[model samples]
Target: MSQHALLNSVEHSDLKVITQAGAEYGDNLWFTPTFPQEFRAVSAYYPIFFHKDPATDTFHAVALFGFTHNDNLFLDGDHWQAGYIPLSLRRQPFLIGRQRFKEDGMDKEQRVIHIDLAHPRVSRSQGEPLFLPLGGNSDYLDHMAELLETLHLGMEDGQDFVENLKRLALLEVVTLELTLNDGSQHQMVGFYTIDEARLAQLDGETLAELNRRGHLLAIYLAIASQSRMRDLLARKNQRLGL
Candidate 1:
C-alpha cells in the first residue's frame, strides 16, 4: 500500500529521503516508463521500446533493464552501474499529483508534489532533508520538483509520439529470444520496436512532419538503443557467473 500525501514544509520538515540506489528502496525493477526528453541519456545505457496496454489499448515507452520481471541488471549492490538513470526511477518516493483551489473566484487544478510516507527511502535522520532548518524547500526538493515537471511533460509528449507511430504503422511487434552460456533459453514476446522498413519507406512529407514534432530523433534513439541489450545480456551472464 502507498501512503501518499501532499508535501508541505511545516508538516514534513523533518522528512529526509535516501538518495542511494538500492533494491530495498524499490529499485528492483526490470523496466520503467521512459520519455523522449531523457531518451538521449536513457538510450546510452538502456534499450528503449514501446509497449501496448491490453486494457487501455494505449501505447507507451519503456527502458528495458532485464529479461524478466523484478530483475534489474543495473542494480549492483546499492549502486546503479549506469551513468544516467531514467527520470521515472530517479523521482522515486515522490509523485506528481493534482490539487484544486480557487484562484480569483475561478476553480482550477494545479500540479502538486506528493510523497509516499511509507517508502523505505523516507526517514528522519538519514539521507537528504526535504526541507531546510528554517522551513524552506531544500535544494534536493527543488531539483525533484523540476524533475517531476520534466517527467510529466515527457510522459504526455511520449504518448503522442507513440500514437503517431501507431498511426503511421512504424511500430512492429517482436519477440526477444536469447540463449544463455549455461544452455538456458529465454523468450519474451509482445514488445514493439521501430519498423525500419516502414520508417524508411515513409514519404518526405511524413518524415518532415515527424522531424518537426521532434519525434524523429527519439525514434532513431530507440533504434540505436537496441545495442544496449547486449550489455544487459553481459550483465546477466556476470550475475549468473556463467
Candidate 2:
C-alpha cells in the first residue's frame, strides 16, 4: 500500500526518514533501474544489463545486485556493501510529482517532491528529520530533492539511450547458468546485454555519431561491467559459506 503526499514542512515537521539500507526498508531488491548518466559509477560495481518491460515491450538499463528475484547480495544486515548504490534505489520512498500553477495567464507545470507515507523508510522518530526546528527543509531533504531532480533528467536521457541501442540492434539475449557452492543450480534468462560483436561492426560514421551523442562511453561501460559478474558470484558463494 502507498499513500503519496506532497512533501511540505508544515504537515510533516516531525517526519523522520530512515536513510539506512536494510531489508526492512525494502532494500532487498535484486536489481534497480539505472540510466546512462550514472552507468560509469554503476558499471564500476555491478553488472549493467537491459530489461524489457513486457507490458510495453520497451527496454531500459538496470544494475543487477543478485541472480534472482528478491535476492540482493549487496545487502548485509544494515550495510550496503557496494561503493555506489543506483540512484533509483537511493531515491526510493520519494518521487517527482507535478503541480500546475498560473503564470502570466498560462498554466505552468513544475516538478514537486512527493513522499510515500506508508513506506517502511518513513518514521516519526529515530531517523533523519525532513524539516529543521524552524520549519525549513533540512539538509537531507535538500539532498533528496537534488537527487530527484537528477533522476528526473536522467530518466529522459535513458529513454533515448535505450532507443538508440534498439535501433542499432545492440541488445542481445543472454542466459546464465550458475552452480552455487551449496550445489544449487540456477538458470537466469529473459535478460539482455550489449552485443559487443555488433557494436564493433558498426560503420565508422555510425560509431562517430554514437560517440558524439555520448552513447559510446555508456555502451563500453556496460560491456566492461560484465567483469563484475564474477565478483557477484563470489559474494554469493561467500554468503553460502562455500
| RMSD to true structure for each model, in Å | 1.1, 1.2
TM-score for predicted model 1 compared with the true structure:
0.97
Lowest summed lDDT over 10 consecutive residues: which window, candidate 1? 51-60
Model 1 bad stretches (over 4 Å): none
- Tens-digit lDDT track for model 1 on 155-196? 999989998999999999999998888989999887999999
lDDT of 2 by residue, 123-241 (tens): 99778999999878999999999999999899899999999999999999999888887888898898999988999899999999988888999999999998998999999999879
- Candidate 1: lDDT over CA atoms? 0.93
lDDT of each: 0.93, 0.93
For each candidate, give its TM-score against the true structure.
0.97, 0.96
